[model samples]
Target chain A: AQSVAQPEDQVNVAEGNPLTVKCTYSVSGNPYLFWYVQYPNRGLQFLLKYITGDNLVKGSYGFEAEFNKSQTSFHLKKPSALVSDSALYFCAVTHGSSNTGKLIFGQGTTLQVKP
Target chain B: GAGVSQTPSNKVTEKGKYVELRCDPISGHTALYWYRQSLGQGPEFLIYFQGTGAADDSGLPNDRFFAVRPEGSVSTLKIQRTERGDSAVYLCASSFGPGWEQYFGPGTRLTVT
Candidate 1:
C-alpha cells in the first residue's frame, strides 16, 4: 500500500532561521508528492508538488522541497522562517503510474516559529 | 478566477439524520474530489469525479455514503443515517484533469450530536 510518513510531530525554529519538515514515502511505481499547509480553521493549502523533472521543487510563500529518488523522500524547506509560516504541514503522495488519485497522507507536522 | 467552493461552512446535525454537502468546482475543471478530515489528521480521500461520472469511490468508508455529479460541474455528497463518527470537515477540490494539481475549498465542518 502507498503511504507517507512525517517523522516529526512538531518542529520549532526561531524567526528568520531556516526550517525543514521531513517526509518519506512508500509506494509502488513512481510517486507524485505534494506539500500542504493548514492554518487553524482553514483548509489545507497547496504548497508544492514533485511530479517529475528537477528534484528541487519551489512553491508558494517562498517554500521549496527536495525530492530524492534514491532515498524516496521529499522534504519541505524554507531559507528563512517567519512566525506566520508556522502551521500544520502535511505530506501526501499518489501513484504517478495512475492518474493523480487517492493521495496517501502523513500524520502531519506542526511547525512553530518563535519570534 | 473563482476557486472551488463548498456550501454550509458549518452544520450541526443529530445522529441518524441525513445530510448533504455541496461542492462547486472551478469553472472548466474536469476533475472533482471529496475528502474527509478529522481533527488532528490529514484529509482522507472519499471520492473522485471525472466529468459527470464517479471515477473512483473506493475511499468511501461504507454504503451510507453516496455522491452525485449529474451536470459534471456541481457535486453533492450525501450521507444516510449519519453517526457521530461521521462528524468531520468535508473538503472539496478540483483540478483541470487527472494528474493535475488540485485546488481546495474552505470545506464544510459537520458536527454530530
Candidate 2:
C-alpha cells in the first residue's frame, strides 16, 4: 500500500525565517506527491505537486518542495515564512501503479509562524 | 474558474436521522471526489466519481453511506441512519483526471447530535 508520513505534529518558526515541513512516502514505482494547506474553517488547499521531471517543484504562495528519490522524501519549504502561513499542512501520495484514484495522506503537521 | 462548491456549509442532525450533502464541481472537471475530515485529522477519501459513474467507492465506510452524480456535474452524498461517529466536515473536490491537481470546496460540516 502507498502511504505518506509526516514526522512532526507541529513546527514553530519566526516570521521571515525559513520553514521546512518534512514528508516521506512509501510506494511502488513512480510516486505522485502533493502538498496542501488548510486554514481554520476551510477545506484543504493545494500548494504543490510532484508528478514527473524536475526534482524541485515550485508551487502556489511561495512554497516549494524537493523530491528525493533515494530518501523517499518530499519536504515542503518556504524561504521566508509569513504569519498568515500558519495552518495545517498535509502530504499526500498516489501511486502510478494503482487506479485506486485515492490520495493517501499523512497525519498532517501544524505550522505556526510567529510574528 | 468558479471552483468547487458545497452546500449547507453547516449541518446539525439527530442520530438516526437522514442527511444529504451536495457538491458542484468545476464546469469541465471530469473527476469528482468526496472526503470526510474529522477534527485534527487529514481528510479521508470516501468515493470518486468519473463523469456520471462512481469509479471507486471503496473508501465509503458502509452501506449507509451513498453518493450519486446523476448529471455528472452536481453530486449528492446521502447518509442513512446517521451515527454520532458520522459527524465530520464532508469535503468535495474535483480534478480534470488522474495526475491533475484537484480543487476543493469549502466543505459541509456535519454534526450529528
The C-alpha interface RMSD of every prediction is 1.4, 1.3
- Judged by DockQ cut-offs, is candidate 1 incorrect, acceptable, medium or high? medium
Regions of model 1 farther than 4 Å from truth = none
Considering just chain B, what TM-score does every model have? 0.99, 0.98
- TM-score of every model versus the real structure: 0.98, 0.98
CA RMSD per model (angstroms): 0.9, 0.9
Q: Please report, as a residue range, the 10-residue window in candidate 2 chain B with the lowest summed lDDT.
A: B95-104
lDDT (0 to 1) per candidate: 0.93, 0.94
Tens-place lDDT digits, model 2, residues B6-107: 999999999999999999999999999999988878889999999999999999999999999999999999999999999999999999886678889999
| Tens digits of lDDT, candidate 1, A4-76 | 9999999999999999999999999989999999998887889999999999999999999999989999999
Residue B83 displacement in candidate 1 (angstroms):
0.6
Tens digit of lDDT per residue, candidate 1, span B1-113? 99889999999999999999999999999999999999878889999999999989999999999999999999999999999999999999999876678889999999989
Error of 1 at A78 (Å): 0.4
